[model samples]
Target: MLVGVLSDIHANRIALDAVLDDMPDVDAMVCAGDVVGYNPWPAECVDEMRSHDVPTVMGNHDRAVVTETGFGGNGMADAGVRYALDVLDDDRIEWLAGLPESRYCFDGRVRIVHGHPDDPNRYTYPSLFSARLLGEEDVLIMGHTHVQAHERFDEGIVLNPGSVGQPRDGEPTAAYALVDLEAMTVSERRVEYDIESVIEEIEAVGLPEATGARLRKGR
Candidate 1:
């Protein structure tokens, strides 16, 4: 089966649309987390994911919005989450809140999480491959760094599809990955979108201007 893996969508509908358009048809798709945060169009992003019935794990931003917890970052980061919460309706909020912190897919051959396997909010770098964390899973999928990575370890394989909405890998294009389980191959892909359009939306919606500017720099 071919699986499209995405993460850190961050509510940019344009980027999400571009990635979806660029991606090849797959049997299923999975998002690591951060479906809503740091950008405008949170509702649209969430709605699109729902329409596709994609199985997603709860991201730190999603948890913060649902639990009314502070992001503990700069004022802009806090504002972004607040804006996302304000724009999302109760049903969407409930859906975000109800998402599992982690999940096992393909009959436990794949493990999906927003951050670390032990902690959903922890920022576990891809460089730190741990057999203890992976356990017996054949593949481990995680996001949260906003960087695309595919690593092979003796214990298992680790894949991060990067940020679909807010990429920070010094590349403006939206990022994702395709995993062919049957073939045991993985391919990373990037799709360019109209960055200015999303930036305009961010400014129009009164989200932090830096949020939009970062897209241009992919920082």
Candidate 2:
């Protein structure tokens, strides 16, 4: 079975749409988290994921939106989270709240989480925790650092699809991953969209201009 793995959507409809359009047919799809937060289209992005019926894990930003636990400070990132919380309707908020912090899929062969296996808010990077986190599962997928990566360990494989909305790996393109369960292989993928359009929308909506500027730089 082919599985499309995505995470850190961060509410950018343009980037999400582009990734969805580029994604190939798969037996299933899963999102690691951060479905909402940052960018300007919180509702639209959540609605899109719901429409597709993708099983998603909760990220720190999604938690902030539902719990009203602000990210702190007056920085653009915090402002984006506040804006996302304010704009997301009750249904979207509930949906974000209902998401699990972690999940096992493919009959427990694949484990999915937003951050680390132990802590959903903690970031997990390649070669850092795979040895400690890997177990009997055939694959473990996570996202949080906004950097695309694929790692293998004696225990299993760890994959990060990167950030679908805000990529901090110096690449503006949306990042994702494809897992071939039957083949036991995983591949990282990137899709380019109209960053300018998203930036314009962010500016038009009065969100921090830094939010849009980050997309241009992929910082």
Candidate 3:
């Protein structure tokens, strides 16, 4: 089966649309989390994910914004995060509040998570132990650092699709991944979109102006 993977979509409809436009047909989608936070279109992003029937896990920023917690102050240093915190209504926050921290196979083969497999709150990337220690997993996917990576482990492969919004890799484009389950291979992809649109929304909502700048730089 073919699966499309997306992560850290802080809330950029433009990026999401661009990725989807170029994405190949797939049976399902797996999101590495952070569906909201550090972006101006949290509600729209959530709605789009739901519409696509994507399976998702929750990230640190998602937890903070959903619960009105302050843990995201560091992860959400970007202007978009601050804007999402201020403008996301109660209903929107509730949606994020309901997201799960981890998802995987019932038999212990495949797994999906935000951040690291060990600790979703602190770890930014998956560890070798997570794959080898987890025991016989076919594939493991995660995201947090907004940098694309593919690591081969003793047990399985660990991949990060990077950030759909708020990418900090000195590039303004959004990043994602495509996984061919049958082929047992994954590749990272970067897509260019209108960062200015996300910024405009942030500014229009009276969010932090720096939020707009982050989108342009992916940081």
Query: For model 3, how does the per-residue alpha-carbon lDDT over 1-219 read when each residue is reduced to its tens digit?
Result: 778899988777788888888788877788989887766678789889888878788987787676566543464344445667777777777777788888874245568888776778655543333455344568888787887778766667788888887787777888888888777788788888887777787677776677677677666
Give the per-residue lDDT digits (tens) of candidate 1, residues 1-219. Answer: 999999999998999999999999899999999899888888998898899999899998898899988477577678879998788999999999889998999898899999988888788776775666686788899999898988776777788889999888899899999998876778999999999999898889898888888899889
lDDT of each: 0.88, 0.88, 0.75
The estimated TM-scores of all candidates read: 0.96, 0.96, 0.87
What is the per-residue lDDT of model 2 for residues 1-219, given as tens digits with 9 covering 90 to 100? Answer: 999999999989999999999989899999999998878888998998899898899998899888888777757768778898778778889999899999999899999998898888787766585566876788999999999998877677889999999999999999999999887888899999999999898889888888888898889
Weakest 10 consecutive residues of candidate 2 by summed lDDT? 123-132
Q: Is candidate 1 or candidate 3 better by TM-score?
A: 1
| Candidate 3: worst-modelled 10 consecutive residues by lDDT | 126-135
**Whose lDDT is higher: candidate 1's or candidate 3's?**
1
Backbone clashes, candidate 2: 0
